[model samples]
Target: MWPQEVLALSRRWLLVTLRERLNLLFSVLQPAVWLVFFAGAMGGAVDSRVVGTGDYIAFAVPGVIAFTVVGNGVTAAMPLLFDKETGYLDKLLSMPIRRSSLIVSRFVFQTVMNAAQVLVILLVALALGVRPASGAAGMLVILVATGLLTLALTAAAMALACAVPSHGTFFAITGFASLPLLFMSNAFVPLSAMPGWMEAVARVNPLTHAIEAMRLLVLHGWSGGVPASLGVLVLAASLLLVLGSWQFARQTAERIA
Candidate 1:
């Protein structure tokens, strides 16, 4: 019975997101523009040493994909915050069901939305000559990793939404937090190229593992040591979900009381 409520909540969120046709375009296009226009405009002159990969397109493609996922994942929290401020979330809590369902549904829908953007990015990458040697196996690994990483980020977003006072504050904080994670990561540049300190930071970034896992899928053939890459992402996401779920339930319960 509890499981059914969770499923229904998740389903309703999915439908609500689909109804917003413009969000569908804005999410995908924002990332695609960065992948195509920004990457193209600055392709030649900016050869940073961290970018060991000779082909500019190869260097940029994976990073673009990572950005798309993170961007979409974090922003998913906005709807919840928006609803609460609008009194919709309080109305939702009046129903006798597990609060976690309300949260899970948003995360589930977010992953779906991000997946749509990824498909477009991948097709554009193919058009630009970034081929995946892992073929079908590689793509499967990429999708699996992506799903995991996105969920993990979604948990962080949920936590942020719960704690923040306003949506603007949430947006500013999440954007500030996300941009650094992307920049300091091995996304655009090789770790070897960074100064010792920056390289060390990127080394520790969980996103680095996710990127390595993804690179193996698209660049290297599906390698044997996939677990290490996946473990970092899945572990981080699991911890965030646990922490966020606890906070969400506690906060919502107090509000209702």
Candidate 2:
């Protein structure tokens, strides 16, 4: 029953997203532009020696993939905010469906959307000469890592959506939080290049682990760090899912009451 409900909800959300053609284009375009323009300009100016790769684009591709997940994942709450504004959320909560399915379905949809965006970024990267050393296997690992990261971010977004009363407040909060998380991580630069204190923070950032793991997979094939990276992502995803589920339950209960 739960599986069916989740799937149905996810399908509905997916269709809504697909119907937004401009949004879909822009979602893909944002990362593609970064890959082509930003990466292109920086890839040429930066010495490969500093980045620890002969091709700076290759080094940056994984980071861009990580960035894509983070960028898209953070917006997972917008749908809920829209629903709430339109009174759709209250209507849905009034239904007999499993309340937890609301959270799960959003997570599932965002995970798939993030994966699609990552694929588009990777394809653009490949066209620009970025090649993963691990080949097909490495691609699979990248997908898994990105999916887990997306799931974690989506869960957090859903929790914030439930807790916040307005879309403006939610976007402000998420934007404030996401930028620091992205810049501090190994998304655009290596940890070694950062200041001592910043490097310390990056060491513990979940995004760092995800980026590092992806770097190892794409640039050098599977390494010892792969298991630890994936493990952290999986654990974070599980914990955030629970948190979001709890928030959804609470919010729904209040509405129903």
Candidate 3:
């Protein structure tokens, strides 16, 4: 079926990804820097009374991981866009593979890669004294929640890469997006301290849910913001991805002509 074709395409993408050493390194370093310098700079000041991590650092591990996966996922479709502009995608379409299969495969591969990157970040968090709040069960739940969120966001990002006109615009959008959202989310501080409006915004941010979910798994165990925030993340990512996919299909179809 198409799913099998998608998986096969993902395998091929992995091989191609291995050739892009700079992208791989930069992607790994970017998130690590955020967790180390940006996070450690705060010292012991980050709070998690509401978000779940005992302190800011622990609370941040998930957010940092989410940031990594998100950065990678949204940019995953960039190469395809470049290929299209350069005539590579046209040649690809001429191959034996089904047209939609190529797109689906790329999305699947990026989702898996994003998940892998987050795992590495999680390992680093363990080394940094950020142990899970609950036992194995909590860790599993957190993993599932994070994976779903990451996968959905990655799809949306890839969709943007497909629909956006140029690599310049894609990178610009990513830069503009990463910082403001991170700051606005509950990654660094509890929403409690913010003005009522900002607090409300943070409460609704998908990133906030991702952070809250991680906080529960790592710091507070089962009693954290598991239910509420996780729900928001899923719902929001789903909506965005649907919109992105629609846009991507429209653009790709135009290009195919």
Candidate 4:
């Protein structure tokens, strides 16, 4: 019953998102724009010693994909926050369905949506001459790492949405966090290129770990770093999922009480 409810709710959210065609278009286009323009503009100026590749686009493909994942995952709270504003969340709390299903379904929906968007980004990268060095197997590993990161981020976002009182507050917090998180990571530049302080921060940034894992798979194929990077992401996903689930359960229990 719980599984069935989660599936149905996830399907409903997927359909709702698909119907918002412009939203979907902009979501894809935002990252695509960064991939093409940002990578193009910065590619020539960057030293090969810093990026470890003459082709910045190839190097940036993973970074831009990570950007897309983080953007989508962190902003995954908007819909639920909007529902709160609309009184829909209160209504949901009163439903016959398991309360846990509401949170799980959102996670499912965002994961699916993020994966689709990432696929389109990969296709665009391919058309632009960015080939994965690790082949199909490497691509699979990239997506797996990406999905783990998504789970961790979406869990955190959803927990924030529930805790915050308004969507505007949520927007402000997420918007403020996104750029710092991106710039601090090896998203556009490698850690070797960063200053000592920034490099220390990037080393601890989950986005950096996730990007490095995917970047390794995309550019270098199999490597020792891939497993370590994936390990970091797995730990992040597991910890955040547990914490987020607790937040959801507590919130729902209070609402019902």
RMSD after CA superposition, every candidate:
2.1, 1.5, 2.8, 1.3
Name the top lDDT candidate. 4
Candidate order by TM-score, decreasing, is: 4, 2, 1, 3
Span of 10 residues, lowest total lDDT, candidate 1: 45-54
* TM-scores of all candidate predictions against the true structure: 0.90, 0.94, 0.85, 0.95
TM-score of 3: 0.85
Error of 2 at 29 (Å): 3.8
Stretches off by above 4 angstroms in model 2 are: none
Write candidate 4's Cα lDDT for 37-75 as tens digits: 989898889888779988899899888988888788777
Candidate 1 local accuracy as lDDT? 0.79
Clashing pairs in 1: 50-190
Residue-wise lDDT of candidate 1 within 163-238, one digit each (tens)?
Answer: 8888999989987899999888878777777889998998778778788788766766667657788988888888
Q: Residue by residue across 99-120, what tens digits does model 2's lDDT show? A: 8888788878887777777788
CA error at residue 14 for candidate 2, angstroms: 2.0
Q: Candidate 4 versus the native: TM-score?
A: 0.95
Tell how far residue 157 is off in model 4, in angstroms: 0.6
Better of 3 and 4 by TM-score: 4
Off by over 4 Å in 1: 46-52
